[model samples]
Target: MTIRIGKIGYLNVLPIYHPLETGEIANDFSIVSGPPSALNQLMDAGRLDVSAASSIEYARHPDKYLLLPDIAIGSRGPVQSVLLLSRGPVDSLHGETIVVSAQTHTSAALLRVLLAEWKIRTNFVTGDATAILSRGERPQAILCIGDEALNLRFHPDYPVRTDLGEAWRTLTGMPFIFGVWIARRDSLDRSGQAVRRACDTLIRAKVWGQTNIASMCALAAERSCLSREELRSYFDGLVYDLGEAEKQGMTRFYRHLAEHGIIEDVPSLNFLA
Candidate 1:
């Protein structure tokens, strides 16, 4: 049986996708590409066998999915892309309406955790953050993630730019895990060998991307409309490996989500053996 995979269609995730899209690796996997939230929903519906899912999804449904070994899209601090664009002072957002991006999962929760910490309560609404970026004087705050957050064309009208990654690190003194690659346990359970092969292929692709960063950066810059220098730095900034530190961060994040009542409880991470 052929395994289907869903890839995130954001520039921040380009390095892991380069090898597959460019046909550098040979595989029989069918591809479904979309934004992070779409991919997460597809996985939830069992439409995709494997996917790059928001870390929060795994935390939310730990029993339904098994994490692939040693792969993540996380950051130590200041993920320039996940920005909280606020029209007023972030601390003064009491009673204001803050619009969460439809494309976000982890970021939306992260925002709530941060606000709870700051004792800043605001009414949350969901909307197309991309469309709202074009407007001014409405939606007092916007949580922009992925490629949309990478754009800095917003006017001075929305000047309060708060980086969620940086804020999380400052608040907890730990790195933040944004997304992770996950496979439905039943899918991998049915084909262990095939699953391992696919996992290795993606790991190799990540290695190839690190070695051939110039090509990756050029392609990413074209798609993101960011300068080569900026793309280079951004790619360099991301940590694609699920190391011990990232796990610790994930645990801390789960605790925060629970403490803030964003999630029911802290879910234990169960990885594929």
Candidate 2:
């Protein structure tokens, strides 16, 4: 059976997916690409056997999925692609409206955590965050993630920009895990060998992609507004490994989420055996 793997269609994941797309690591897997939020929904519905989905997805439903070992999309500081742009200071936005992109979950939740920690109360509405700015209509703030954040990080209308990863690091002093690789538990139970084989292939692909980041940056440059050098620097700040520190970071984030009532409780990380 062909394993259906979910891929996040963003430059941040190019390093991991480039090899698979180029046949550098040959496989018979079927790959489905979408935004992180969409992939999370697909994984929850069992439409995807495995995916790189929002970390919150796993925290919310730990019983239904097993994490892939040693892989994640995270950052120690200043993840340039997850940002909050504000017309005024973030602390001053109490009771003001903030336009949040409908394409994210983890980042949006992280924003809420940060706001709560700062004792700031703000209204949130899901819509086209960019359109408000493009149309010269300034909301109190706007939240953007993935390529949209990268594109709007420097927009002049919002001078007060906060990088969510940077804020999380300042708050927790740990790496911020945005997305993680997960496999539906039932799929593994039914096709353990195929799932494991696909996992191994993914690990190999990650290793290759990390080593060939320059090539990946070249590919990203052609499609993005940033130059090759800028893309390299952006990728440099991203963390792909789920090591001890990354695990601790994830746990810390879960704790904050639980404290803010964003999640029921801090769920334990369960990896595929």
How much does each candidate deviate from the true structure in C-alpha RMSD?
1.5, 0.8
Worst 10-residue lDDT window for candidate 2 reads: 129-138
Clashing residue pairs, backbone N/CA/C < 3 A, model 1: none
Q: What is the C-alpha lDDT of each candidate?
A: 0.84, 0.93
Residue 68's lDDT within candidate 1 is 84
TM-score against native, each model: 0.95, 0.98
Report lDDT (Cα) of residue 110, candidate 2: 96
Name the lDDT value of residue 19 in candidate 2: 89
Instruction: Compose the digit string of candidate 2's lDDT tens values, residues 56-103.
Output: 999999999999999999999999999999988888899998889998
Task: Look at candidate 2 and give me any clashing residue pairs.
Answer: none
lDDT, residue 56, candidate 2 = 96
Model 2's alpha-carbon lDDT is 0.93
User: What would the TM-score be for candidate 2 when compared with the true structure?
Assistant: 0.98
